[model samples]
Target: MQSLGPLRPRSTVLVKRPWLTKPFNWRALSSIPPSDYSNQSRGGLPRFFSETLPSSKGGVIRVQGDEFWHMTKVLRLKTDDRVELFNGKGGLVEGFIQNIDRSSIDFVALEDPKLVLPQTPQWHIFAAFGSLKGGRADWLVEKCTELGASSVTPLLTQRSSTISDNRVERLQRVILAAAKQCQRLHEMKLNHPMKIDNLIPLVAKSKQSFIAIAEGTPLVSALTSTTKESSGLIIVGPEGDFTEKEVDLITEAGATAVGLGPHRLRVETATIAILATLTLWSGSQQISNC
Candidate 1:
């Protein structure tokens, strides 16, 4: 009688034990301890830097660039030491020294690291600055990247002193170092050097653009409203400033020439002032959304 009828299929639902479900929820389902999730939930700064990288492919990385020299020679790090690492690609990891030799050292990746995204301002600043000599342009690029310039373009103007274009790699190194120091996950871009006449007409065609000229137009009057797609390009000139012909050309090309401040500034100083103003403007716009 028991074997006469066909057996019905059993349900595939298995009850999970309390302990099993609890650990799985805490570790697999959710990240970090529930009590400490306040900051993590709100997307605050990550606790660890480059030191907590996991052993997975691409999760953990090593920087053989000047960073290696800085780590070994400058910082005098040795085996068993720990450090945090970040690749400009938004990957952060914590790593420990596995071995230390004369030339290079191995850092063992430990835990799965959390990637921290940079809160880059909504707007982008393309600083087309006239060339400066004696590493002044290099300094300009470094500070600009630090202050949140999305990109930079070196301008070979009528008044420029330095025309040698051999410092691109050096400028990139400075940008990378600045990004790392500032905890900025976004990479700063450095475009090729171009003549002011050529770049202005090309850029002036954009929907959102402005040129910073310390005398022609008032700064406050230019930024009357901040729309979602608000952006501007600041043109900083050499010691003697942009040639009148160049200014005329840009003005004819539909670029809104704006001033920075009451006092005329050096090229480097002017670039920083413009960048600071733009950064503040971007912040004000972001807060206005609330």
Candidate 2:
């Protein structure tokens, strides 16, 4: 266990303004042309698709579904158009459109596939959050993927909102879109919804785990003091926060009860804050060691 010393209060004032009040750069906005595959930069901003195949020299792969539609009908790409392909299993290949048809497009690998290894120590944030309403869960998934959470699991807590199977599917799609935008070679794993009690034993065995609470140790202190080889889970409560019994169960199970700051953060805000803090803390620790 690590000591967080004393908790302190922090505050900031935010101002809101209308977008129309700001000066507009109409020319700068107008200068941007419509997106076309031909004008796509070479080795820069290449469109990404997920099609796993042999990475051997000159291997051919096929692109279909929404990806094929976007490349052909939407972007109007034709033969010889270059694109980047990843399998979300550490494979990244540079390929070019070899042929386009009514249903699919063929791609010819132009170079040997490159493997993007996971970060050192391979820290994984197993975010077990309650089901959020509307787009909140979707936003959380997208941001978590960008923040490099290895996996995210929706927790079924006593106070958690209802999460349908279809919602899980939608969240998975959000993860995929975010991964493509972030150019992540390895996709973030979105696990099925699980009971919070089921997560207790796993937390006890985790290399490191923290539960975000309002009146606990400061997260920064606990994280900075951790060993460089540490990697584990983070659990966040839902709207109205977790029940007292749930809190006791997690704390007793060996998870450190941590706090972001003085303010009570919304579920999505807290999720982002926790992930962002851990990411920065890990990166900074690595740099200092070097």
**Per-residue accuracy of model 2 over 125-218 as CA lDDT, tens digit each:** 4344545667888999888877767777776778885567667767777877787776555667776666777888887787777888899788
Best by TM-score: 2
Model 1: lDDT to the true structure: 0.55
In candidate 2, which residue ranges exceed 4 Å CA deviation? 1-45, 120-130, 228-230, 284-290
TM-score of candidate 1 on Cα atoms, chains taken together:
0.69
What is the clash count of model 1?
Answer: 12
**Local distance difference test, each candidate:** 0.55, 0.66
For model 1, residues 111-215, the per-residue Cα lDDT tens digits are 554444444453334344444657777788777766766667676777674434446666766776666655554456676666765666565555555666757
TM-score of each: 0.69, 0.78
Instruction: Give the TM-score (vs. native) of candidate 2.
Output: 0.78
